[model samples]
Target: MNSVSRRKFFGLMALGAGSMAMLPGMAFGAAKAKTSAPGQTSLAAGQAMARIKALIDELRAEGRAFAADALASDNNAQWDRLLNHYFDRKGFASISVNAANLCPSLKPVNRMAALVRDLLEADISFPMRGELAKASLGHGLTAVKDWFGLGGSDAKADFLLALTANSTMGNNFVNNGLVTSGFMDPQKDNIVVWDVNHPTNYDAWMYRKATQGWGADSIRILKTKMFASSVTEAERKAGTIPSDPQNEDEIIAALLALVDERTKLVTLSWQSNECGMVLPMQRIVSELRAVNKNIHIHADSAQTFGVLDLKLGQVDVDSIAGSFHKWPCGPKMVGILYMNNKHGAAERFTPSIWGYDEYINTPADYGFAASTGTIDPNAKRFSYLGQQNDATLVATWMAALFHTGQLHPGVTPAKIEARIHYLGGQVQQALFKHLPKVFPDFTPKTAAQWIATPTSNARLRSSVYLFKTPDGIVAGDVMKHVYEQHRFAIANLKVMGHDLLRVSPTICNNAKDVEDVVAAVVDVILAMKKKTLANNTHTRSYA
Candidate 1:
């Protein structure tokens, strides 16, 4: 992944932070893993990582070669072997690729991505132009009836191939939803969202109302203060969820409280990237719909995309945009946007980047008349952003399959959540015990409050934890000492005027990792204080 184009970035002057995998030991079409060593159950981590590097080199070469070979021949049998070999993993259903299930108009990179998506059973309804592109895209789209609902009437969010940058997708979804709901057309509409100062939930709404000089429509922001470190202590000790009677309800009511006929759209986040705060989206959507049935709801799920399960059938959000790199452990600079076309959100979502229109034969069906006009009726309307990294795009599916399929013990999304929450809870509990003694000035209000995860029934928390230090202790200096001395690369960030320490615990991390980081943090803070005292003593002695 490389720097996103400034043009694309400027489009996100407000929104949230943007943030792939493959399998091992197995091949496609009933191929078995040959034993490298006798009775070898699995490869070592170092070996596994090295294999991934080698695999990337192989994929780049083989993918390009296959595309080139695919170009010269029209035979489906020829390319099917190559596609199935690289794409087919252990857990997923078998998939084959050819002109019938590939987006023809796409450049080779995008075509490879289409093949990966085809393996994931995500149909293509993209709006990219080319007499060749339309036919190519449709071949892939016609494969799956529903991407997310692979089983019975599961009614989940579908998989659409959206080759977009992360921050750009949030604004795209929100603005498009608002526009389609007749809010952004100078019609007076009230937009309600969170004001944690995160770009996705906060400032993008600000730009639309303030930047566009639309003074008639109102934007009410839901505001909340950061909970104290003590809160985490109480929750951990009690071994229960926080009873923040005032905080949770207030946040939900504040947004739903603003709903009325004038309210046309509401955009929010599933998790805050800066703080590991998970909002009660399930309930927030539930209450919002009850109040204003017409409000178009969109969620920025960059941090929670691969972390959360297929519960969208309950939340019923109109649109969700997320990145592959963060929790999914995939590459960066790639984003996935899912729309609720199954539940009638298709007509309500108008693509902001309606760059091309060639997927559907009846253009009028999707509000487009001809080649240069109209958005696709499906979420594919948003997939028309110009050129994209083909390798990274295709790798998204590979990474998705790797994590959701191959990441062991905690394999499914539900299991993954449990592992992360357990790790995060460990850090939360340890910090509660260590922070006070480490910094005498630190007096938190709640014991285990930061362990707050909004999904009550799921108990699925983010793998991230945050702690703020006083002015005398520079967070960057502490971060430097920890990284340099202890080899612990903890994040030192400034959010909402507070200099904070951010820690993330994943499958790669465990209780020992948390203990090591806490110990390092204690040493760094104490060392800084000792150095400060010595300097003060030297200055006084000289004075």
Candidate 2:
């Protein structure tokens, strides 16, 4: 890759088709404010990124030693290192590439939005460029409130752009936390249950109990299932494990016996992108903040954000959504939603969005006509739901400068969630020893249930795992015939109701990219078992 070989870098990008039209997303040409010259707009945004430096020299020839060198088994080098780490070259001159030569002042997009509010701890000037621990969801809600003693709860954190940390940002944080937690007496807020067992986070709290006003008896269903653990060393020498008829004290006593006292809210997903299973979510947000410290928890950490070590200022929540292109290689409608400034407090969060002055929660002593309106007491009052662009909000500070490794200190979101729970349990013990010699109907789990240590025989480890499906094939057609015969990106998904195959590994994955993706899923299940034993001996020689 370093020698520029994607067929000689698409044959030198066929000698510039107008510099490959800013090569799609960032070679920029449309920003208008004609009157050039003031370092001629950072030299035509560094000469349109020096003619997009032959696509940043083919993304610095595939890898610059890191930037999540594409969670390996070479998912076509993690989709060309998530598109050249979001087209960056010295953070693409703070990503203002030629909107006439961009940066028509929001003062460097408010200093890259205060360097992402100082990498989520605010006041930030961009220095911690190595072990990147600064306020990533306030250090993952202060490591789930000092590992669940819920250090005197009440949390606050905010940033926006979420999609799969639960869709429509988990139904607008349970319909704006039941219209700013007044929870208007429906038989005293008595139902908001979850767990059609993680049907994509119980169909987002059953799509706000069937479209708005948290109805249909607020919500119901705690019947859970998502299992996968088949532990071994002879099932840990016969101590056995996969008995998951839904554990975690039976999903926290089926979500604390569907908390009556007119429950406010309680979304889930501290883990379970279809069963990699972690859900303790600090004993379900410290036993629902000891059963109602104003319940409205919301976690949906879409496959557990940047791989756990989270802090969110001591974990008993009020809100927290996730997404930054999973396991934080960042970009893709970037996301972060952490409310709890006393329920987005600028005096009990009233601004649903007021960039044009619904008086964004006024109080500049309502004088300069309360300076074109107020609002933002937290969770960025659901971060401006409409037009607010300073080059995609300064490319969310070059995707938080490649997630606080200042664009490349060789990746960190706590080192790619401890290399996706120890190289995703060594690619699930090399797919439980090459999937029963190429599909005798494989079913794996438990090389001591993927070892990331919790010991009462193991619990904390999610890097993503799963297998089943050989019987009548069709899990997306052997996942597109092992990704068109072994380039192997992997993952088919749909957990408890079958499908499976999901692998899941990240952080420039080593161990020979999990032994070249379990030897290309054993050469794509031995070429679909020698074309299904030559079509069952040509259907017994045509009967």
Candidate 3:
């Protein structure tokens, strides 16, 4: 009997069972072995299939039992062990802490590989694939609802899976909904957003193309100051200013002042990607609802969805758009759009991109009767946008399971949040204690001035820590030099004209990772500063 290589088996699997029949040197039955072509399979391929199938079944069952047992156990030590095991399996490096941009875990990648194998098995036909894909989507939605504690009472709220990024969903809510509802008069009506919100390519399209088409003046952005630089020097020294200033009542009041009878929609980033400043969502939503019950509130929850403990049902928002690739450690291009259907909020927006479902009538009438063409009343209406990668969708459900501890019981969303914040605190403390010593010329003295993120308020702080770079050095130049020299992955962003280095440590990181990143940053900045000074001295001698 010949042994089948793993690569060959997966290649056969990728070809699928249907395509395998057309291969030149292949045999399916035992009796045809003698007459089969060279390098072909007869009984060995069958045995390989059987062995692989058994292995898959055993692993799946064992995983389920292990998760159940772990969840049932009350031992904290056991829980910690399982958590470490999960992180170790991901094969993430400690020095690479860039979770704010994308998760570095290989768990989703491995799970996706397994899903592809399962999906290509003999029993799964095309129709069966569709059924399984829908089931996975349903599982993901249920997991999201359960995590947010919106299981029973908030049953009316539905989640729509967007094939595009979160920005498309935002556009659908802000531009399409307002235009379709006829609630906004181009001459008088306006929309409100944060001035420092992270602008995506879709935002550029909406602002330049969509708004221009509607003849609207401009999208009104709230200039709510939330940075340490926005405060006076005395306030910085006295520690009167918090890192996250958006939580203040005065800031909220000023934001609400921009909303008049003409304001039809208000969109806000629940957490700023620039500085990780978490907005007071519940308070903002409640006050906005008090002012106008019909106002459409859309939250760009890209930064806070998986990292923060969110109760979607509690917050009165028309829609919340986010993606799983960020903090959820899921596959890319998988976005979620949560529609608050309790108050008929889901019906306000028509589909921005038309699909086959949009043309179909209710009850899917295909007979000769006169049909009333209507889009689906549920989230399914947004899902039927042509062909999508079903494998990625199923992997998204697996990713959700991974986070909620259904797949592995040791790690939960709360634990992940705690780990990220703990690492974040370590980074903050290291920067505050060591930056001045390394450079000796480091200015702004106070931690408030040194750190762009919120330091005074613990509740407002997130895993994302944006700190100032040296004045003479460009943040981007320092970021590139650090990655090239030290292989550390961080971000350099300019928000509201302030260039800063962003360090977002996730659950996979440790205290040591934080210390190493801070130390590497200091070394890189110092080296760059010396080179700049030497060059300046040479130029001065020539002058």
| Candidate number of the best lDDT | 3
Q: Candidate 3, residues 1-543: lDDT per residue as tens digits?
A: 112342233323333533322111122233221233675433233333333233333434545645544432224354444446545534544356777777654354355546555645633343334333333444445566666546555352234333344444554544554566456665667777676566752264256446456545446656534455345444433223344463466446556766777777788777777766777888888998888888878787778777776776677677777777777767676777776766656566665554422112222332212254455554545554544555565556556656666555455676666666666677778887678965465544456666777776666777788877767677777777667778788888876667778888765555666788888888887887788422112111000
Of 2 and 3, the candidate ahead on lDDT is: 3
Those runs of model 2 whose alpha carbons end farther than 4 Å from true positions after fitting are 1-180, 184-261, 270-297, 302-320, 323-326, 331-335, 338-393, 397-426, 430-507, 510-543
Better model by TM-score: candidate 1 vs candidate 2: 1
Candidates, ranked, lDDT = 3, 1, 2
Overall local distance difference test of candidate 1: 0.49
Cα lDDT, model 3, residue 438: 54
Indicate whether candidate 1 or candidate 3 has the larger lDDT: 3
> Candidate 2: global Cα-lDDT?
0.44
TM-score of each: 0.64, 0.33, 0.75
lDDT of model 1 at position 91 = 30
Q: For candidate 3, what's the RMSD?
A: 10.2
Pairwise TM-score winner, candidates 1 and 3: 3
